[model samples]
Target: MNGIIGKKVGMTSIFDDAGRNVACTVVEAGPCVVTQVKTDDTDQYNSLQLAYGDKKEKSSTKQLVGHFSAAGTGPKSDVVEFRDMNLTKALGETVTVDEVFTEGDKIAAVGTSKGKGFQGVVKRHNFRGVNDATHGQHNRQRAPGSIGAASYPARVFKGMRMAGRDGGGRVTVKNLRVLKVFPERNLILVKGAIPGPKGGTVILHK
Candidate 1:
C-alpha cells in the first residue's frame, strides 16, 4: 500500500486530452516525512508512519514534540500509517505526491465528511415525510410521522433512522482517478468529489 497525508484544497474543473470537461478535487498532498518505520520483526507488521502539515509548538504536546524531534523533523498536524508499501524508506525522509501517485492512477481518499449539525429525517435520511398535505395535515410535512408500533414493540427500536445529527463522520471514497500531479507545488488533482470540507485533512491511498 502507498499512501500519504494531505489537505483538501477544494474543487475545480479541467479539460482532458479529449477536451472533455472533468470535475476534480484539488488536494495539497504530501511533502510528508517518515516519522517511523515498522517492520515485521519489530512491530509484527510492516507499516510506514508519515507526518505532514506544520503545527505550532505551543499547540503540540511535549511528547509529540519529542517524537518528531527523534525523527529529525518538526511538529506536524497530521500523522498516518500506510502498510505494505513497495519501496523502502528511512526515517526523516520526505515523501511527495509525485513519488507515490501519477496521472490516471486509481486511488481511494479517506476523510471526514462535512458536518450538517442537527437535521430532520427528511434531510438526514431522505424520508418523504407525509407526502400528502390533505386530511388536515399542516406543519407535519417534514415530521417523522411514526417511530414504532403501539402494541408489539412499545418503544423505538435500535438502529432506527430518525431526526438527529448528520455528517461529520469518517468516509472513504474509492476508485478515484488521479487527474494530475504537480510535484513542484505538491498538488494532486483527483477526478470527482472527496469527503471533508475545504482545508480539512485527507488521506490518499493506492
Candidate 2:
C-alpha cells in the first residue's frame, strides 16, 4: 500500500485529453515526515507513522513535542499511520506525492466530511416531511411526522434515522483516479470530489 497525507485545496475543472472538461479535487500532499516506525517484534504491527504540516510548540503538549523530537522534527499538525507501504523509510524521512501516487492510478481518499451541525430529517435524512400546507398543516413542512408506535414496541427502535447532528464523521471515497500530479508543487488532482472542507487534512491510499 502507498499513501500520503494531504490537505484539500478545493475543486476545479480541467480539460482532459479529448478536450472534455473534468472535475477534480485539488490536494496538497506530503513532504510528510516519518515520525515513528512500528515493527511486529515490538509493537505487534508494521506501520509507518507520518506527520505533516507545522504546529506551534506553545499550543502542543510536552509528550507530543517529545514524540516529534525523536524524529528530529518540530510538532506537526496531521499525524497518520499506514501499513505495508511501498517504501522503507526511516524516522524523519520525508514522503512526497510522486513517491506514493502517479497520474492514472486509482486511489482512495479518507477524511472527515463537513459538519452540518444540528439538522432536521428533511435535510439530514432526506425525509419528505409535509410538503404541502393543505388540511391545516401549518409549520409541518419540515417536521418529522411520526416516531413511535401505539403499543407493543412502543419505543422508537435503535439506529432509527431521525433528526440530529449530521456529518463530521469519517468518510472514505474510493476508486478515484489520479488526474494529475505536480511534484514541484506537491499537488495531486484526483478525479471527482473527496470529503472535508478546504484546508482539511486528507489521506490518500493506493
Candidate 3:
C-alpha cells in the first residue's frame, strides 16, 4: 500500500551516520488490517481501505462489528482509504510499516494540527500589531487594524485573514525524510516534527 495509519509517539533526537544529532518525530505505524478493496469496475476507482486501532466490541455498531467479522478482526477505531494503492491482498491481510517505507525515503505526513481556539490576528495570522507600544496602546497592541474602508465597500471582505479559529485543521507536511523504521515495534522515525499532539493519529504516505 502507499500509506499507513500511525499514532504520534512523540519526538526524540537520534545520532545519524554523520554523528549529527538529528531530531525526529516518533510514529507508531500500523500492522493495519485490509478491511475492504475497491476496484475500477466495482467502485469506479482503485483504492484500499484499511482499519487501525482496536475498538471495544460493545462500543461499536452492529453493522461495523459485522463488517469487521467479514475481515476476521475485531472492531476497529480508524478506517482510511488510500487511492491508487496497488495491492491484491485479501480482506483480512495485514500491512506493516517496513513493507512500504525505508530509511532516507522522502514521504508526507498528514494529521490534524493542535487546536489553538479563538485567537487574534497577531498569533493566528502572524500580523505585526502596530509595531510599537507608544502612547496609550494598552490592549489594542494586538488588535487587527484597518479592516475595511469607511463608506464605499463598507462591509468586511468575505475571505479576510482576521482571526476566528486557529489550528485543529488537517495539515499535510511533505518532503519529510524517513530516518528509521522498526517493523517489529511498529514504529517509524521521520525527520523534523509532524502535526497534532501526542498520541494523535497520523498518516504516513509515500
Best by lDDT: 1
Worst 10 residues of 1 by lDDT: 129-138
The TM-score leader among the candidates is 1
TM-score, per-candidate, Cα-based? 0.96, 0.93, 0.93
> What CA root-mean-square deviation does each model show from the true structure?
1.2, 1.6, 1.6
Q: What C-alpha lDDT does candidate 1 achieve relative to the native structure? A: 0.95
CA lDDT for candidate 2: 0.94
lDDT for 73 (candidate 1): 92
Could you tell me which 10 consecutive residues in candidate 3 have the lowest summed lDDT? 130-139
Query: Which candidate model has the greater lDDT, 1 or 3?
Result: 1
Instruction: Please list the residue runs of candidate 3 whose C-alpha ends up more than 4 Å from where it truly belongs after superposition.
Output: 135-139
Candidate 2 residues 154-180, lDDT tens each? 789898888899999999999999999
Q: Mind giving the per-residue lDDT tens digits that candidate 3 earns over 113-187?
A: 999999999999998887567776777778898889888787988888897999999999999999999999999
The list of candidate 2 runs beyond 4 A from truth reads 131-138
lDDT of each: 0.95, 0.94, 0.92
